[model samples]
Target: MGDRRLAIEAWESLFRAQHEVFGKLSGDFVGSDLSQAEYDVLLTVTRAPDMTARLRDVTANMLISQPSVSRLVDRMVGRGLVTKCSDPDDGRGALVTATEEGAHAFRVIGAAHGRSIAEHMACFDDEELRTLLTLTEKLRGYRSGE
Candidate 1:
């Protein structure tokens, strides 16, 4: 086994780095129509086929509780950012589809956010970035294949 002290130190470093980076990126939503949570929801929705995704899937990808995700979706519906409906294939499931306005907002903020992420991540070279990606994925219990 690896040194326990070294493992804890590494984990602390990773946590601090993530906290600092997220704090910086949180500014991307300032004065915007979408909050960080909304953007996160749309991020998954917009990438899904037909700009739609399962509510469960969205919730799975989020850091918040399932009930919180439901409430957020309700609020988004009220704002006309997205439409939520029961999934015909599964009575217990719901589907969310982005409205045109939501898609437009996502695109706008997504562009700027992308640039900001690139700028922040530019400190790492291509090789280092790849290594970081692999290490993070491994730490998350993600493997190349099931």
Candidate 2:
């Protein structure tokens, strides 16, 4: 019973911390060409080889639902930030590639966003940061069956 209560407390703390941090960090996107979700999609797309990724792969990396991701990708396409093409290997699957403009915007926003993250995380020492990363990844991996 004590262990279960401790677990619940820990989970609540984690949830509240994430919500606070994300809410604060989301301000970095204001006035940028991309919203937080759009930037997230571009992050995966831009990091892939040839600046392209499978749409499903992008969806997998995102926090949003697959349908929401598809809609977001459509809006991004309309904005000329990305281009969509049918995957050659899998005809039913679509691929998303960052346009030159998209890459440029990502780079510009990425530099500032990196600074924002660093500022927010500066409270943690290197060891603490490492431990945090390891624990979070462990939690995620458990859910992902890794």
Candidate 3:
């Protein structure tokens, strides 16, 4: 019973921390060309080879639903931020590639966002940050069977 209580406490703390941090970070996107969701998509796509990634891969990395991602991608395509093409290796799949314009916008916002994140995270010391990273990775890895 004590262990279960402790686990619940830990989970609540983690959830609250994430919510607070995300709420603060969301402000960083104001006046940018992208929403936080769009920036997240670009982050994944820009890091992939040739600045392109499979739609499924992007969906897997995102926190949103597949249909939501599809809609967002369509909107981005219309905005000329990304291009969608039939995946060469999978006829049924689509590939998303960040356009040069998209990459430039990402770079612009990403730099400022990075600084904003660092500022918000400044409360954590290096050792605490390392431990937090390790614990979060362990939790995620366990769920992912990694």
Candidate 4:
């Protein structure tokens, strides 16, 4: 293969390896009582000023589709981890807000997740990490012809 193909292959290999590591860690974090996707949604809600976001906002940040988001939100609602509210901007759209319980749980879980990422990525120098981030962002955007 050409140099470009080799570079792409190398990147893909490393990405796959990292993904596997994350999968294992995620599984081990069952104590947190949050799936990786649920955690992402929680994070999004917690980071918002009102600890709430529109359904589409969370969907955009998640790895799932609209239907999947709806199902997941319903599950979360059932778990008392989140509440669905009517969106003020749109009568038909729903807003997702983390309940007080969800915020507390997310705090605990987010800390654990942060520690996990820190431990795993500790080997990379800050500059190396920044370069990798820049390269990946560039590649991601390039693939979309941005």
Global Cα lDDT for candidate 4: 0.85
Judged by lDDT against the true structure, how good is candidate 2? 0.94
Please give, for residues 1-146, the per-residue lDDT of candidate 3 as tens digits: 56998999999999999999999999999888999999999999999999999999999999999999999999999999999999989999999999999999999999999999999889999999999888999978853656
Which residue runs does candidate 4 get wrong by more than 4 Å? 1-4, 142-146
Model 2: per-residue lDDT, tens digit, 14-94?
999999999999999999878999999999999999999999999999999999999999999999999999999999999
Which regions of candidate 3 fall more than 4 Å away from where they truly are? 142-146
Model 2 ranges off by over 4 Å: 142-146
CA-lDDT, candidates in order: 0.96, 0.94, 0.95, 0.85
The true-versus-predicted C-alpha distance at residue 99 of model 3, in Å, is 0.4
Question: What is the full ranking by lDDT, best candidate first?
Answer: 1, 3, 2, 4
Clashes of each: 0, 0, 0, 0
- Per-residue lDDT value at 135 in model 2: 91
Task: Give the 10-residue window scoring lowest on summed lDDT in candidate 4.
Answer: 137-146
TM-score for all models, in order of appearance? 0.97, 0.94, 0.94, 0.85
Residue 48: error of model 4 in Å? 1.3
Query: With candidate 4 superimposed using the best TM-score fit, by how many Å does residue 124's alpha carbon deviate from the native?
Result: 0.3
